[model samples]
Target chain A: MSLHHQIRQYLLDQAQMHGWLAHAKIPSERELQTKFHASRITIRDGLTKLESQGFIYRVNRKGWFISPPRLLWDPCHRVNFYQQARDQGMQPETEVVSVNPLYDAPLIRHQFGMDYGNNLELLRLRRLDGRPVMVERIYLRQTDFPGLAQQPLDGSITELFANKYQVQINHESSHILVCGTQSEEAALLGIPEGTACLHIERKRYDANDRLVDYNLEYWRQDALELKVSSRK
Target chain B: MSLHHQIRQYLLDQAQMHGWLAHAKIPSERELQTKFHASRITIRDGLTKLESQGFIYRVNRKGWFISPPRLLWDPCHRVNFYQQARDQGMQPETEVVSVNPLYDAPLIRHQFGMDYGNNLELLRLRRLDGRPVMVERIYLRQTDFPGLAQQPLDGSITELFANKYQVQINHESSHILVCGTQSEEAALLGIPEGTACLHIERKRYDANDRLVDYNLEYWRQDALELKVSSRK
Candidate 1:
């Protein structure tokens, strides 16, 4: 095998072995060059191959780090996303990036049952164990919650709905696909612009069959593992 | 906006309007340069951005073509994938690429109820509307199906098992993730190696609750739209 191929395999084996893995940074290109006596280009080629394969990611100045196992998601789980992560022994965090109001939004207006085409959007940045995982934009009508803007934003919206407003999620429909990150999302996720991402679009309904929520979530491609029962 | 951005938006508007799109080849870089009086780099930058955003794709010898909408997939659908695609007004095609035998595969042994670890693997390439969409690898134990090698390979395995073998899929568990395509899968799907893809791992059960089938499907990221209800 070529030197670059050898380097790729060696790094893969290092990652597969728990001893050398973790979100830990691998050797720098200079370090690898000195250790392996290979050209800088060769080392770079190996690292680029690894990055494209989703085994590692580079943070602008921080160099490269081993990617963690994707967070497993089961659509049948009855809890919210954060709780689900916690159940898997992961520390999940959610921050309210921004909250704004939308009026006369034509495309999304029909998705809701409200007579008026007015809605509130909550932008959230979420992390798993300190690594940026997802950025979610949640949309809902302001008329549904008169004082929603006054409520705390950093907490779980699901829990807040149940405890504060006597609301619960009955059922929801979702669409998942692969897409590229735009500038805003790229900045939040710490990935490059146009990086491949897992895009999820969801709509939640209440007992009365009212469209209670609509959400768009963009996740780092390596951070999501989706498990579904069936959808023809 | 810069000339390249203008070129990108023009192509996007053309595709979204559905007037000039239909998988038809867009102008070549040289043609685009003449038409827009822009540098070759400018034309390429626009096309590159569109490709990265999943708006278009290129064949090896052919030029760029607009990408179609993702095929919708629902995990709760009662029918098989091909049937579902048919219902959506798409011409689905399946081809048997290869089949092989395996022995002493320890990793997969316990996933089946069979006492022995010997199994057979069926490799298939599936297309939608003449576009290669997925490459599937199916694994099963030979002891479960006598004379399985003689069975027709191109048709639906789900249908074949039901009609010829009296085996029906009762329930299945599946995992989905965003991954990079390997060389074999990339070759079959006509995509570059390390391209982002949607990876699905599924295990199907029979009426008797035995693991009857194990399948791994690699799909072009732009070709799949997955819908799941909940797993949290």
Candidate 2:
């Protein structure tokens, strides 16, 4: 491998081990040249390649910094979270936070397709790897999944849909993008108020056109990445 | 039409005539009952429906305000600006801000697929729905369209691609979300500094795996809405 590629890999390994994903200003070109024992041109070549790949960026006078790649989600596909992570070569993990019945709220009323007075249920959590990157609040229709709160939901909700409910989520449409974390959201994602987060408000329905699940996934901007390979 | 629909349309028409998107708060339930000569429940129901559909969102102590739906561009599809606007039932218009050839900047060099020494031509603009919504800075590879700088690029670049270079951009990937308007971006978007704006970064390519266009579209947050329908 080339010297620049070697240095790039070394830095990437360090980042992976330390679990740092946000942009970081590293040593200047002169310092990198002396430390990596490479020419300035080679260092620039490596930095430029990393920037193009959405791994790092130069901020005017501030030398170079690591950057998380943008995450590309195809609204056309209804793939689950774990599947989406695996496709991107990431280790997908989950932990249960809370599962409780929702009572007399607008959110629950809408999720359960219940009458104005009917009840609903919710599962909220701080989903993460080594660090919490997202807070997922899922509202499930109680009529469709009775006793779901009593079952083990720490694993895959997709698997639950298939094996337990015998339902197949063939398609889903998501409204996905970024937003400044609100006070409540910030606390859950373990970030400062006004930190950037990728918010995915998704509606998962069954084959019969019933609203089965609604999810709000707040992903930490620093810890996630996505790419798009468009079809012609 | 129902009284609520009449009121909604009245608000919308007023918004259009004033050439702005936001509106004064609606009369309180008591006031609405008197003005519309309807029950408070009816007025509340109408407001609730609109809020659910994202036509409006609450602002804590402040009452309801008209919300323009955001434009959700699917990165998987090769949809152009005009098509995106048309889908939202809005008339999209553009004014050419400036078109010039540039070179030497690393960012420009990377975007236009230019050699370190090559020149790139840019077409800048403030786009609108009969009123300004965004300012776009578009960079083109001069190698692909040698005489592009001399053409009338005031119209859609997609048309220019077809006519000048015989290239049809079949797919585009975009990063679309809210961002605080930087000083320079604010000046271009005609908004105050720190105002929220939608920053859309896109890379367009043709059918043969060749990068053809690059665009940065910065839109005022209050100026647009995004809607996506997904089936599960």
Candidate 2 residue pairs in clash (backbone atoms < 3 Å) = A70-A226, A71-A226, A171-B232, B69-B224, B69-B225, B69-B226, B70-B225, B70-B226, B71-B225, B71-B226
Question: After superposition, which runs of candidate 1 have C-alpha atoms over 4 Å from their true positions?
Answer: A1-7, A13-19, A27-49, A230-232, B1-7, B13-18, B28-49, B230-232
Task: Score candidate 2 by lDDT.
Answer: 0.62
What TM-score do all the candidates reach, one by one?
0.88, 0.61
Can you write out model 2's per-residue Cα lDDT over A123-225, one digit (the tens) per residue? 4554433345567778766767776777788777878878988877765656665454556666665544444455777777777776667787776654544
lDDT by residue (B1-232, candidate 2, tens digit) is: 6554566676677667776554445546677678778887677656644543345433434566665556566645446778887877777777776776674567867765534445464646555444456777787666778777778876778888897788988776666654445566666655444444557677887887667777877765545434345432
Candidate 1 at residue B161, lDDT? 88
TM-score of predicted chain B versus true chain B for each candidate: 0.85, 0.62
Stretches of candidate 2 exceeding 4 Å from the true structure:
A1-93, A103-120, A127-130, A177-184, A190-197, A206-210, A220-230, B1-69, B72-91, B111-119, B127-132, B163-165, B176-183, B191-197, B221-232
Cα lDDT tens digits, model 1, B77-146, are 5467778888787889998899888876777666775466579989999998998989999999887777
**CAPRI-style docking class of model 2 based on DockQ:** incorrect
Largest TM-score belongs to which candidate?
A: 1
Docking category of candidate 1:
medium
DockQ of each: 0.53, 0.14
